[model samples]
Target chain A: MLAFKLAFKNIFGAGYRTILNIAVLSFAFVTIIFYNGVIDGWNQQARRDTIEWEIGQGQLWHPSYDPLDYFSYQDAHGPIPEGMREEVSAGRLTPILIAQASAFPQGRMQGVLLKGIPPGQAILKIPTHELEAQDGQVPALIGKRMAQSIKMKEDDRLLLRWRDKNGAFDALEVTIAGVFDCNVPTIDGGQVWLPLAQLQEMLGMPGEATLLVAGEGFTPTGNTGWAFKDHDYLLADLNKIIQSKKGGSGVIYGLLLIIALLAIFDTQVLAIFRRQKEIGTYIALGMTRWQVVGIFTVEGAAYSILAILLGALYGGPLLWYLGKVGWAMPSGSQDMGISIAEKIYPVYGAGLIITTVLLVVVSATIVSFLPARKIARLNPTDALKGKIQ
Target chain B: MESIIQIKGLTKQFPVGAGKFTALRDISLEFHRGEFTGFVGPSGSGKTTLLNIIGSLDTPTEGEVTVLGRSIAHLTHKQSAQLRNQHLGFIFQTYNLFPVYTVYENVEFALLLQRLPTAERRKAVLDALEWVGLTDKMDSKPAQLSGGEGQRVAIARAMVKRPAILLADEPTANLDSKNSHHILQTMKQLNEELQTTFLFATHDEKVMGYLRRIISLEDGRVVKDEEIIMDKITEG
Candidate 1:
């Protein structure tokens, strides 16, 4: 402890050098913090969009559901297991039947996959539904592109006709309660969400659903796949499926780590050069050679700690701002206009910050080792003579 | 007086390129407790090398240096450091004060080497400072003081720990005549009052005149070992 205190005092003793070294480290700190924040924010945004679109916190599939299966929903049957319902008792689960169908809205028709959702339960899961300006009545939300194709609006009438299992035309009257907008333009243009009861009646399956999509924070002990638990997992899976074609955050983070290592190395090497005489003096005064090495290593560690503190002070607020106003990606289709969130969400995780600080300090200290060793091997007479090599 | 430092035919060699140069040839010397002794030699006469051997800064190539009954020739580097801390004090001609430390802090460094308690160290340091008549300038840094004041601080540092032996390498080389005389008197007073052994390497005549025993060397070999017999009139 006494040696550590002495080292600390010596570092601060050279006031101008300490300040200059910190300034150089600060530049690296800002670069690393901003890069980490942006990548993390984008990842979180993708997860949010994924969970909002398809999978909820806990998704239940059959015990036979394949881990590598892309067509599980098409082969599955019935709604969620009875026990799974009790697990998420506080949050509602929406049973959905997804099937491809040919729709003729006004004689110019196209094939669209109609996802029959449990209407009342889905209201709590969709972001728009939760934030709707309701006036004492529940509204059926239809995508903007679906409304535009049928030339419909709120209170407008539309006829959705599809062929059933028996090859007979099954038609229904769906009132356009409201027009909805999600950032994914392709899904918005082709997808239509209807009440499960209405779909069952039209297709003549009185009380059955093919798939179940729950909201965030659902847990099922028996069986589940592609499931989400809390915000982080949901974001991870969401980023995986939604932004699969774009550049990933892992590459960006790797590059950022390299830059951080180089910056810390440069700064620590400079600091070692400036304190050459002092280190030699300490060694000549009966300090162990390793003790001399330890003092500078500790100084490097202190630099990392200070940089992390400063980075957190700035990065926290920056992430919060990004979460409030996320960025957008351009959509290739006119009808299905693609735009991600305007600003990405920030995650204030303690583990990530600590790991980053440790990484920076360890690399910087290792870089400073060559100089520390050189000082330890210095002849006492040469040191007292003030000769530099 | 019992011998505090015993040397047996010590030698040191320095490598210059492919050939080896002898810095100190086979020679032996002893330092007794409570003695004021001086080693006088010309430049490159191996005075500094001999001093370093006694101070445990350099190892002998052929023989052993036993200080306080411990063989330093075979001790590890760490053990040598421990030995120096426990039994040795050094005053350099450059005054080697840590530029960032005040005179008080510089003096306290020696006591800290002994690992004494803070209160005891403070008392010892202040007392040493008073002994050198630099108590009024204890708070001043070496850069803020004259060359003489800096040398006095170095003296206080060497004496503060009250080690078994103090090694001084040309302690008055940088000081003027007046400061040199004052420093010599202060050292003599310390030797008489504290009964501490002082060993110095010097080329100055003033330093030789103040010593009770002088050993002169040329070509890395001792040429004369003179003991000044004190008379009653000369003592005054």
Candidate 2:
């Protein structure tokens, strides 16, 4: 208790020096929490967007289908199993037929993926209802990114060519029924959506699908001639990307902590060096050498405590405001080939704050103790004389 | 006339380069309660060394020294600290007050080590400050005080706990003659009123004039041990 009292007195008595150290430490404290909070928020936003716009609760893929390998689209799909046909009709599962195709817009050839889904499907957030044929023309939906690249808009006509299962090529004039805006780049760029019946007829493959998306809360059972992919498997890539970003941010955290701790370490060393007489005075006043060490160690740890108070003074309101208004990501972020939204609101968990507090306080204490241990070896007589030991 | 500090054949040595330099040779002494005693000598005469052993700040190389009935040589670090905290007090020439603490806090520090109760501690601190006539400067930091005031605060700090023995090493070395005499008179009065054994190591003549007993040393050995007749000398 005496050590704590004296430590606080000494720290406050130090005046501006104490404030400077606290400022640096508080910077580290607030920066760490804010950076991690932003990353966590981005991860959460990306995960939700991917789930809502692309993968629902999970997915079921055809046995031979490989989403990453474009050549698999040629022969990856098969007839939908009889057991899952009821699920498809009940809207619990939505089947999608994908084919590698080419589109000619303004006489410019561009390769695209033609995905066919039920016009009235409600499993995903895509504007598939606009895919209903109108006025003897095939109506299709494209993402804003795809529409921008093709220079096509609603009601614009484009020539789409694809090969059927019999190696026969077919061409058709499709009208752009709608252009939807989506944050998930993988679901947006280079993709066009059309009615399942039209694509199936064009490909001469009826009742066939490349994949099945399970709706919210839907659980797969029995044989469906397809592999059930759970959320963990479906979101593995996204999780890996998030983890990688966190790893990169870890370096910044380390550098910040090291800088703050280095300042504290230097101050501790200097205090011990200059306060020899005061140390001797404590010994002379009946304090044990260990007690003297405790005073110095607590003095250093007290910096972190002060910093926590200082950080909360300014950082609290700033963090709260940021959480409210969110951070707007710069334009063209969608082209990074990963899921990111326009604005991300940071999520600061109780665990993050507690863990950060412990990390800083514990680190400050250890650095303080390192230099204070030298006091145990100090000769009281020499210290009284203000002689270096 | 109770012997509270007893020393017999004490020797202290320090390492200088490869060889050991003996600071204090075989020496024996006894200090009774309430006596105003001073160890007088020139530089390198081992005055401070002998005082340090009595204060339990340093141990003897070869002797049995006892302070307040505990063997100084055998006392562990904690026991030595307890001995100092409970029964002994120390004052240094440099007035080693904690620069950050105020005069009241400095005086209260010794009593704090004893963990005195709050009301009692406050009373004791105020009384100690009153003794040094520093009640008006209780809130002033050491840096704000003059050298004499600083030394007086150090004296108050040493006396706050009312220890059985007070060891002062050149307490008035940094003071002018007037301030030195004033500090000595205050200490002499405290010694008389409280019967607290006052032991000082100094070469200052002003301090020697106030001692009831003087032990002079030359080269590491006691050269003269005498009792002063206070009535023969006029008050300064």
Candidate 3:
């Protein structure tokens, strides 16, 4: 306790030196926390946007379904799962039928993924409610990215071609009902949504779907003809992308840590060198060499405590302000082929805050201890004389 | 009377180039209760080295020294520190008070090291400061103090523990004549009142004049030891 008090006194007594050290460390604290908070916010926003725009609470895929393999999608369609029929009728489950097709927009041919969804279903946010089952022409909904790619627009007329279950080629003219804008690229780019029943009838395959999306708060009771995909498994690829992003950000974190520790280490070394006479005075006043060393080490470590306090003093308001206004991403960031919002709010999580604080405190203590041990080996007589050796 | 410090044939040496140079040689001395003594010498006469050995700052290279009942040569580093902390107080010529601390804090430091109770530590520190006529300068930092005042604070620090012996090395070397005489008078009065044994290593005659006994050293050997009449001694 005496060592701590004395060290505290010594640190504040150091005037500008102590303040400079504290400022450097506090800057590190704010930067580290802010960088981590942004990454966490991006991850959170990605997960949420993916959920609302693509996968709802969870997904159920056909046994043969393999999104990466187009041929497998041909075999992916099957009759509706028997157990999910009631939920499907109650609007709790939404089934989507996928097929590969091509569209001729302004006489230019472009490949597309033909997705069929219930016009009145509320399970996802695709704006398929604008779809009509039997207009004078098939009414379709396309995303802005798809519309831009095909040179099509709202209410444009186009020709879509596909094959039936029996391998017969067919074509039809469709009227674009609406163009839905979404953050999820998987749903937005090169995709067209039509009424489920109409597409089922057009393909000559009634009552078949490639996937079923459960609404929010729905739980799977048991196995149907399809395999149940929980949220984690469904978002596994996104998690991988986030983990890779965290690794990339880890380099920045490492660089910041190196810079911070170097400053602290330098300060500790300089202070110990300059205070040799004081160290000797401590020993002469009846302090054990270890106790003198403790005072020095504790004085160095106390800088971190002040840094944390200083960081909170300025960083708290800065973070809160940033959180409220959010960080506006660079324009056209959505084309990166990942789901991301235009603005991301940084989150201050307990886990992140605690981990960062612990890392800083422990590192500061270690850096302090290294130089202070040098004092213990000094001869008191030489130290009292202020001899460098 | 039992001796508080006992030194027998004590010698200290330092490595110089290839051979060793001896600082003190074949010196035997005993310091007892309430003695105000000074080791008088010129430069390189080993007065400070002898004081260092007795203060447990250095060990004798050839012989044994026992102070306050503990053998200096056999004690570990921690035990040596314990001896200094518990039974000995030191005042240096440079007045090496912690520059950042106030006069009172400087005086309170030794008591804090001993982990004395707060009330007792406060009283002892205040009393010691009063003895040195520095109670009014309790809040003055070392940088704010004059040379004599700094030395006085050092004296108060050393005496706050009321140790059995006080070791001062060139205590008046940095002070002016007036400050020197004033500090010496304070020390004389402290010796009379507290009966604290005072030992000094000095080349300053002004310091010598205040001592009750003077031991003269030359070339690592004691040449003369004489008791002085306190009434007749005068500062040159």
Candidate 4:
């Protein structure tokens, strides 16, 4: 307690020097929390967008299906399993058929994935119900990115050509029914959606699908020929991407902490060098050498405490405002081949805040203690005379 | 009178290059309670070294020196500190007052080490300030005081704990004659009223004139030990 009292007095006596150190340390504190909060916000937003726009609660793939291998789409489809038929009719499961195709828009050839879903399917947010055929033309839906690339709009006609299961090529004209906006790039780019029955009939493969999406809270109990993949398995790639981003942010955190701690360490070294007589005075007043050391150490650690308070004074409102209005990404960020929303709302979790505070405080204390240990070796006689020993 | 300090064959040495330099040679001395004694010598004559040894700030290299009742040679660092904290007080030539602390805080520091209660600590601090005639400057920081006022504050800090012994090394070295005489008179009054043993290391004639006894050192050896009769001293 005595050490604390003396330490506070000494720090305040330092005046502007104390404020400068606190300002630097508070910058580090606020920067660390802000960066981590932004990354976490992106992680949360990306995961949510991917789940809502592409993957549902989970997915079930045909035994031969490999989403990464385009050739696997040829043999990936089979008749819907009898057990899952009831679930599919009940809207608990939605089957989707995918076929690699090419589209000619304005006499330009572009490769695309033609996905077929029930017109009334509610399992995903693709606006598939807009795919209702009209005026003897098959209606199709495309994401905003795809529509922009193809230079087409609603009611525009395009020639789509694909090979049937029997190795026969067929061509058809489809009218663009809708162009939906989505944040998940994988689901938005280079994809077109058509009515399930129309695509199945065109491909000469009726009552067949390449994959089944499980709706929310629908658990698959019995095993069919198709394999069931849980949420973790389906979202592994997205998780890995988020983890890598966090690792990159960790480096920033380290750099900020090192700079702040270096300043504190330098201040402590100088204080010990300059306050020798004061140290001797304390010893002469009945304090042990260790007590003197404690006073200096506490003096250094007190800088961080002051910084925390200063940071809260200014950073609190700034962070709260950022969390509410969100940070807007660059216009072309959605083309980065990852799931990123237009604006990211930072989420400052209590755990992240507490962990950051502890890390910085503990680090500052250890740095402070390092130089203070020299006090234990100082000779009180020499110190009293302001002599270096 | 109680024998508060006893030194026998005491010596202190410092390493100089590859060789050892002796600061105090084999010497014996004794001091009793309430005695105003000074070790008078020129610079590097070991007067300060002897006072430091008696104050328990440094251990004798080759002798058993006892302050109060604890052997300086055998006292651990903590025990030495405790002895100094509880029974010994020190004043320095530079008046090493904590620059940031006010006069009151500086005086209160010693009692704080003793963990005195609030009311008791307050009374002791105020009394010590009154003794040094610094009651009006209780809230003034060390840098804001003159040389004499600073020395007086230092004196208050040392006397605040009411220790049995006070070691002062060139306490008036930086003060003018007027301040020096004033500081000495205040200390003399404290010695008479409280019976606190006053020990000093100085070559200043002003300080020597006020001493009841003088131990003169030359080249690390005590060359003269004399008791002064008050009637023979001229008032200056």
User: Would candidate 4 be rated incorrect, acceptable, medium or high by CAPRI criteria?
Assistant: medium
Candidate 2: true interface contacts recovered = 0.78
Listing candidates in order, what is each one's chain A TM-score?
0.65, 0.96, 0.94, 0.96
Candidate 4 stretches with Cα past 4 Å from truth are B232-236
- Candidate 2, residues A1-389, lDDT tens digits: the string is 99999999999998888888899999999989988898999999988889888888888899989999999999988898888898898998899999989999999998989999999889889988898778888999998888888899999998999999988988998999999998888777888788999999999989999999999657799987799998899899999998999999988987998899998999999999899999988998899999999999999899999998999999999999999999888888878888887888999999999999999999999999999999999888888888865
Estimate, for each residue in A1-389, the C-alpha lDDT of model 3 and write its tens digit.
99899999898888998898888888888888888888899899899889888899898899999988988877789999898888899888899999988888999888888899999889898888789654577899998878888888888998999988888999999999999888788998888899999889888879999999999757788778688888899899988988888888878877877777788788888887788878877887788899988887787679888989999999999998998999988878887887777888988899998888887878888898898899878888878778855
lDDT tens string, model 1, A1-389? 65556655665676765565555555455555555555566556545555666566545544444323535534544545565556434555566655555565666676666666654465233433432324543334567667787676776655567755455787655556667765444346666666665666666655555645566455445544423344454345445543553245446655665555555456556655655556545654666667767776676666565666666677567656754665343443334233355444544456656666666667666755655566567665555555546
Each model's total of backbone clashes = 10, 0, 0, 0
Interface RMSD of each: 2.1, 0.7, 0.9, 0.9
lDDT of 1 at B152: 92
- Candidate 3 residues lying further than 4 Å off, grouped into runs, are A132-137, A147-153, A216-218, A221-225, B15-19, B234-236
lDDT of 4: 0.89
Per-residue alpha-carbon lDDT of candidate 3 for residues B1-236, written as tens digits (9 for 90 to 100): 56888989998898889999999989998889889999998989999888878888878899889998999999888998998898888999899888788999999999998899999999999999999999999999999999999999999999999888999999999999999999899888888888889999998878887888999999899999998985666542
Put down candidate 4 lDDT per residue, A64-153, tens digits, no spaces. 999899999999999999999998999988999999999999899999888999998898888887987778889999888899999999
Judging by lDDT against the true structure, name the best candidate: 2
Query: What would the per-residue lDDT of candidate 4 be over residues B1-236, giving only the tens digit for each residue?
Result: 89988989988899999999999999999999999999998899999888888877787889889888889889888998899899998989999888878999988998888889999999999999999988999999999999999999988888888889999999989999999999999998899998999999998989988899999999899999998887644363
Error of 3 at B219 (Å): 4.0
Each prediction's DockQ against the real complex: 0.33, 0.84, 0.72, 0.79
Of the two candidates 2 and 4, the one with more favorable DockQ, higher being better, is: 2
What's the best-to-worst order under lDDT?
2, 4, 3, 1
* Minimal lDDT window, size 10, model 1 chain A: A123-132
Q: CA lDDT of each candidate?
A: 0.67, 0.91, 0.87, 0.89
